[model samples]
Structure formats: structure tokens, C-alpha cells
Target: MDRIRKIFLVSINNIRKWATNPRIYVLFILITMFLWSSIRPILSFSKEMGIRVTPWVFPHLASSFVGQLILMLGVVLLFCDAPFIDEGQPYFLIRSGRYTWGMGQVFYIMMGMTIYLLIVNFISILILMPNIFLSTGWGKILGTLAENHGESVNEIEYISKKILLSYTPLKAFVLSFILEWCAGTALALLMFVINICLNRAAGATIASLIILLDYAIYSNFPSVKFFYFSPVSLSKLILIDSKGISNYPSNEYAYIFFIITIIVLSIISVLSVRRKDIQVQPAV
Candidate 1:
């Protein structure tokens, strides 16, 4: 219990800067930009048609094959500096040793990414709340857009019929949060492990590449066969077939994939802390 407490405290210390860092504003700005890109096309249509959407805009964005790419790209920009190495880290590492400190860093990444997602989700709800009323279902604008298959406007974002039928609005929001939180943690761990083994540039570059590949696969490949090659794609609930009848992966598959990836990466990170000569530097 004491060891766990220490690790929790260590994780808090690691993330404290993010709270104080002036760069936090950049994350807010990125959230706005990414959400705008996803919802902009439908915004005008909603206003013109006087559509009051439900407070379930998140799944609409997360379920979009392309919008998933944009949101994860925003994640990359926010947390690519995993292990968040700084001048103070060596002292902490020296005190806690490799295993304990590495666990702290891992916990920090998990908490950090979850908080980022929370902020993004909050902003998303606020955006919808202006004209939105409490509703437990997809409202008029989204229903019409889904019915028309998003051809009602030019390149609009949409929640597909499959997603609408498979999960209610509340379920969709919960699924989006959980899936995205897991995927973002995996991405942060990817950066931490690579940076520990190699360098920061390599870490950030590889993580960015994975997200770009997700976009490429959605844009060009358009097959569930390729989703395995891109970790970010695994987070998109839309691509995962709810009925188990489609070619896409199952929700169970996504949960298992994340569980396996996170466990493997967690083990590697803890083990490599002693052996890998990490000169991980801090970012502002």
C-alpha cells in the first residue's frame, strides 16, 4: 500500500507541470480545431434546419472513420513527450529506482491521457449544449444526417446507422471515452518505450506515423484487414461490428487488443528501465 501510494504521488508530481504549463492552452486550441474540423460541415446544416442535437456528439466524431484519425492526431500532439523526462526525473529515478519509477511514469501517462480526453469531451458537450436539451437519444439533426448517410451536406461528419442501432446515445458516449482512453494510453506507452530505447525524435516520429497510417488506411485501404496494422484504428467503435456479422473486428476484439498491447508494453517498459540506456529529455 505504501509503495502504491508513493507511485501515485510520483505520478502526480510528473503530471503537475501539465497543469501549470503555459503550453496547456495549446491543447485547448487543438481540441477546438480538431472538433471544428469534424463538426464544421454539419454545423451549418443543423442551424439551417433548426436541428437541436443530443448531447451525444462525441460518438458522432469518434465513430467517423476519418474523424477518429483527427482526434488521435490531436492526442499525439498532446502527449508525445511520454515519460516526460526532465531534470528532476533522474533524482526521482535514483530515489525510486527503475522499477518503481517506471511504474509511476506509466501511471502518469494513463492519468494524463484520461484527463486530456475528459477535457476534450467536456468541450465537445459544451459546444453541443448551447442549443441542446437533455435527451437520451440521437436528436433530429443527427438522425436526419444518419438517415441521409451524411450526403445532406458536403463531407459532413456522421454517426452511422449501425452505431445508432447497436448502442444508445449514452452507451455510445461511454464506449467512446473508454476505447479512446485505452488507445491513447497505448500510444503514450509506445512513445515512452521507444524513447527509452532510442530517442525522443524517434519516439514522437513513430507515434505520429502510426496515426498517419490510421488515416491512410481509412482513406485509401478501407478494409478491416488493414486495421490490425494501425493501432489507432482499433479505437474507432464504428469499424468494430456490433452484430458480429461484418468483416470488421468485434468490440471484444478491441478490448482484448488494448489489454494485450498495454500489458505487453507495460512489461517491456518496466523491464527495459534497468537495461535500456534512456537519455529521455523533457519537452516544454
Candidate 2:
């Protein structure tokens, strides 16, 4: 209980400091809101064209937002250098349980991500609902068009069905978090590896190379199960249709592959951190 309390206090203090930083949070909020707001027009346009939108749209936007969140979070972890030795007179000593401290950081990151996702989701739902109604209620306009074109209402039925079927918020959040955690952690690990290897610039180059390689392989040859290790591939697995993942009929295997890959990657990351040398250098 004492250890848990200590960890909680440490985490709380870290969050407080972060929260006090107004500029970063403000910019983050603005960018996310802007992205969420942009979807309104798209929803309106789709409705006008006799197309229905899916609730899946929210999660898709959320996924992209989470990706950007992960990227920013990675920069913070890498540049701030948490749980590692810092030369600036250790403010809070790990003293006994270093593992706890590391775990605390993990928990903090996950919590921060969850909160961010929830807030953005709430804003998106608020902004999108009325626009969706306007788009779908174009009954008279649609009727005139259908009569002129000699087409039946069945032409727009697919969109209507899609709108009705696609609003899986719970599923979207679960899938979004899973992909976000995997991608976020991977990026952080990559940044850590880069920091250890060739300074910031070199690490950026290597990380970019890795991302490109991951995308290239997944796009060209997805049949190989190992590609699931790549965050992009993992996101694809979550977002794309089961068969869309490399044409394999059974997606069960792909999911299993992703789980195993995430485990392996996580283990490797922990080991890397455990063995990493802590030496402060110029922040790049």
C-alpha cells in the first residue's frame, strides 16, 4: 500500500506539472477540435448526395487524433527523459522500487491517452449530430433526382443501411485504444533506441526509415504475419475489413499475430530500458 501510494503521488505530481503547461495543452486542444470540426461538412455533403454516414466515422477520426497524440507524447517521453537518471539533482529518488516508477510512467501515459480520446469524442459527437440530420433529410431533393434519372430509391438504400449499422462507439474506443497503445509505445521505444544510437537527428532518420519500411511491407505484401509488428499495420488490422488484411479469409490468425507481436515488442522495450545506460547529454 505504501508503494502504491508513492507511485500514485509521483504520477499525480507529474500530471500536475504537465497540466500547468498551458501552451502545449491549448495547442493540442485546438488542433484536435479543428480536425473534428472539419468532418461536419463532409457529413453534410455525404447526406446531400443521398449517402449515409457511419458511426465508424467517429472512431476513424479518433484513431487519427490518437496517432498525433502518440507522436506528441513520444516527443515528451524522449525529450523529458523520465524514470531515467537525470543530472539535475534527482528531485524524487526512486530509492527502492525503480520498476514501480517505470510502471507509473506507463500508467500515466495510458491514462492521459484515455482522457484525451474521451474529450475529443465528446466534442465530435456534439458537432456532428445536427449536420448528419440535415444531410439525411434531403427527401424532396432526392425524390426529384431519382425521378429525373429513372432510378429507384434503392440506389440510396445502401447509405441508409450503413448509417444505421456503423455507429459502434464502444467498439471504436476499444479498437482505438488498442491501436493507440501499440503505436504510441512503439514510437516511444523507437525514440529511446534512437536517443541511444545516433543522437536526435540520426534517430529521426532511423525512425522514419522504420515507419516507411513498415508501411511499404504492409501495403505491398500483407500476407506475411510479421508485418503486424508495425504500428501502421496494426492500425490497418483494426480499421480495415478482415479480408482486407492481405486477402486471408481468416482474420483470427492475424489478430493472434498482432497480440504476440505486441507482447514481444513490449518485452524487448522493457529489457532495453532496464539495460540502457543513463547519461545526460544535450537535449536535441
Which candidate number would show the highest lDDT if scored against the true structure?
A: 1
How displaced is residue 84 in candidate 2, in Å? Answer: 7.5
Worst 10 residues of 2 by lDDT: 155-164
Candidate 1 backbone collisions, by pair: none
Compared with the true structure, all predictions reach lDDT values of 0.78, 0.47
Instruction: List candidate 2 segments past 4 Å from native.
Output: 26-30, 46-55, 62-89, 129-173, 193-209, 218-229, 237-284
TM values, all candidates:
0.91, 0.60
Candidate 2: pairs in clash: none
The candidate that wins on TM-score is 1
Worst 10 residues of 1 by lDDT: 36-45
lDDT of 1 by residue, 196-227 (tens): 78777788788888878877887788567898
Q: What's the distance in Å from true for residue 271, model 1? A: 1.5
In lDDT terms, how accurate is model 2?
0.47
C-alpha lDDT of residue 191 in model 2: 51
